[model samples]
Target chain A: MSELRTAGANPPWDGLDGSDRHAACMVAARDGDRTALDVLVTELTPLVWHVARGNGLDRSTAEDVVQTVWLALLRHLDRLVEPRALVGWLVTTTRREAQRSWRTNRGQVPLSVELTEQLPTEDWLPEDEALRDDRDRRLWTAFSRLNHRCQEILRLTVLAGRAEYRAVAEALSMPRGSIGPTRGRCLSQLRELLNAEGGSR
Target chain B: MNDIDPRDDDRGHEDAAVLTDLGRLVHELDPPPVGLVERIQFAIALEHLDVEVARWERAGSFAGVRGDRPGTITFTVDNLTVMVNFTSTGERHRIDGWLVPAGQHTVEVRVADHNSTTTRADDGGRFVLSDVPAGTTQILVHLVNSQGEPGRTVVTPTIML
Candidate 1:
């Protein structure tokens, strides 16, 4: 897990911090830098994925929503005035698109189940055969036990990283000041759940 | 900095550690479908920025039965609609396309990693593009105004063949 902390230690955008790197990429992408645009797409896609999946969309629908969001971004590339707001823009757009897709899909599949109940199964990738370890399973079980809001917050904060907290807060429609505390409380709760699971085992 | 509570700092550190682990776990458990980024990059790598992007209306056949039967897909943008019926032709593919509100417009089949094929549609809005080497593909309809001059272009979302 510690090795994961160094995963992006040497980002391509030198000198700039995480959020600033995204901002710089956005500016470059808007200016028609293909490389920068690729960077932006690769970097923020995880956050977008979480947002879409968090909204209770099945895998295929989530994939379509993700594609639609990126295409929408390209259509409005020049119109995005604030490069710093890129994450928020993407998050908000993904949420809206996911909701739309969810409503559309509801026509085909009867969705009487709660959104949280659908999360674990609908969002689970079939290729996650590697998630076999006991600790990972325990962690995932604890994570699934969380209410939808906490899960959404935790996933977004983790993927978006600490630097883009403001954008994430705005996207989630929470007061900017409360994001940190809420995230802290969520992490604490997850830890408690993990401890409980471990004790019962 | 010294006035900051050490307990708060420790808590923050613990939260950071938990987040790092959680991030890794989430990514391992359910990452984006493979090559999604590449697919998007291919889709948005348009030659013209001012074109209207067409939304995929419906696909007629299952991908598994592609070569066995002619697969049809329709894309629409505003009043204009483009539908393509494609079939695997041995080593290549054949595409029969129709554009509604028929006119003699230029239709280009953009294939990734291959030279794009361009052909003009008949006044009835029917066109054919043959020998298209299959990979990822999109369609571009160059509208011609009443004066036979070029108008706004309509681009379709990328589809894998």
Candidate 2:
């Protein structure tokens, strides 16, 4: 499917090009083409890894979560309905796995910015601090501290970009119509937390 | 006091910040494990071979099929007494190898993971306890056709005697 190479030389995302190619590879993977699945894993691993770390999972836990996601996909490939929704499915699954890992571990390490450094950074561009200022970090910290229900709600809405009421309902087990108002309330609560922490920063 | 709408266009700057941080964080997140793609693909191919075998077997059409399975292949050496099992279409399922006399003779076998090699057969597939070379342990045979594609699901988990 894919050639063996060093991460420094041939990064996982070297050839994603755009979202369309990403979508194409997903379709090919579902069709049982190893070559296509190779490209799909290579291109999408970054995003899945990111989602795991972003959700407060530590490096090792996040790594396990990622591997489990791939293995789970191996066993459940035939269950995927819409090929185009592969990204959404992967994102949702990664988040769930990451959360589960962190929760099960309980008192070990918490998710922090350090989790982001587990991978090499040769391909990464510098971050703009104006964008990732103290406020952002605080929001992330608060996000990490949120109750599981709110965390899941915000995750489905703000993070993975799933706007369909039905999908959000399915993911969070809320009524289909409750998604909009619930999302608004969650964001407002997040804003309150962000604003309260602003003075100290 | 001031208020900001999370979804307003003017907050493109804030959105840009979140995206930038998220992108950087994502970029730094570890890639999938090394050799993962190959391992997964190998597994998927193996699964497909199994499905194909089950279908053929169910349809009663796998009588003489050969080289459709993916795995290491094992067989007797240099024994024309080898009986060939044929599919209804009359094809050989197991390839014949020339059984050589004792001491140390190489019996050719194919490994399903895209590798091929030979093992020493004491008296063909007869010697119950012959020691194979260190690197030439028992091979789980899955014969591929001339095109090098998996052909049949013969004996799975086959070990060279």
Candidate 3:
């Protein structure tokens, strides 16, 4: 996998980083091109969704948060001068909105906290209906058992889209220059969990 | 600087492999809901949406004194704050709302997977959308010139009505 990633050595989607592409799309959308805005929405929807859901919001609330972020961005997009700030801005907004959902329904149990209780140890992929194989199912179970912070970091990495370690600093609030070591530790933790069962069904 | 660390590169490879497995696991586990893209597309595709995207400030619902009636939901955007009270009459839902800093503008109610309704606000920034079927929905405020070209537009997130 690493070989394939580094084999090209050049980033995909034209060497423009994720933020640059997003900002460019925003500009085009502003110029009356609906298609450009669609591109922006498509590119960032996953990132925004994961940011909300990964932080512990249920699916419905997470989707709400994502839509809220888009609406907010529509108002503030022109105010954002630098393009690179886009990802950081979107992730932070998602987290804040998800927290708002929590505050609104204080009586409602948080999906993240109630997760373990809702799903017994045997079923880790409860959120997923299409579990392809037993090996993946085992890995998911171990993953679900990860602490919230670890789960958050790994999930953001999955959505970074070749964003480099700085995405950790920007998205996860990790200190600058420490994402490499932090990611290494997090991965080793998962490796330990997977290897415990020989990573098989 | 000194020579590149071979162990560091090897660890990088290891981390990528682990993350790949992690990605596969999570993607399969919590898949995004179907039709998310289309829903967002419809919400974002207002005739004059590119004018400006309104930022969400705060939202809350307050119950009545007796608690027997449906609660009122208040949604605040940067340029406007909308307070919606829902009442069901016969087979249709009624959404009575007010806009802040307000004047008459076209209020469009977007229902997910359902038809939308448009209403015109009064001089007091108040409007009532009557005979609307209840479902998951949201609102958009549009300002149009005398020539009928749209000006600034404000959008709210899709919510249940």
Best by lDDT: 1
Q: Residue A78 error for model 1, in Å?
A: 2.0
How do the residues A1-201 of candidate 2 rate in per-residue lDDT, one tens digit apiece?
246333455543345444455556556666665566666666556556556655655444454456556655654566676555666687778776665555445543533334422322221222334444675566555444444444444544443331222322233332435654554555555556656767323
Docking class of 2: incorrect
Worst 10 residues of 1 chain B by lDDT: B1-10
Candidate 1 Cα errors over 4 Å, as ranges: A1-14, A105-129, A141-151, A162-174, A177-201, B1-20, B57-70, B78-80, B100-104, B145-149
Better of 1 and 3 by DockQ: 1
lDDT of 3 by residue, A108-200 (tens): 444453352233233222554466766676677667666544565678776553343233335443343555555556567777787785753
Instruction: Write the number of the candidate with greater DockQ, choosing between 2 and 3.
Output: 3
Q: Model 3: residues >4 Å from true position, as ranges?
A: A1-20, A107-125, A128-132, A161-176, A195-201, B1-14, B47-74, B77-93, B96-106, B111-116, B120-127, B133-136, B141-154
Q: Tens-digit lDDT track for model 2 on B1-161?
A: 00121343343455434434433433333334455444333333443423211000111222122233422222232222222221221221233332212222333333334344544334443222122222111222233443546543322212211
Model 1, C-alpha of A11: deviation from truth (Å): 14
lDDT per residue for candidate 1 within B38-92, as digits (tens), equals 7777777877666676766533212322234567877777889898988898757
Cα lDDT of candidate 1 equals 0.69
The CA lDDT of each predicted structure is: 0.69, 0.42, 0.63
Q: Each candidate: fraction of true contacts kept?
A: 0.31, 0.10, 0.41
User: What is the TM-score ranking, best to worst?
Assistant: 1, 3, 2
Best by DockQ: 1
- Two-way TM-score contest, 2 vs 3, winner: 3
Scoring each candidate complex against the real one, what DockQ results?
A: 0.32, 0.06, 0.26
Better of 1 and 2 by DockQ: 1
RMSD of every candidate to native, in Å, equals 6.5, 16.4, 8.5
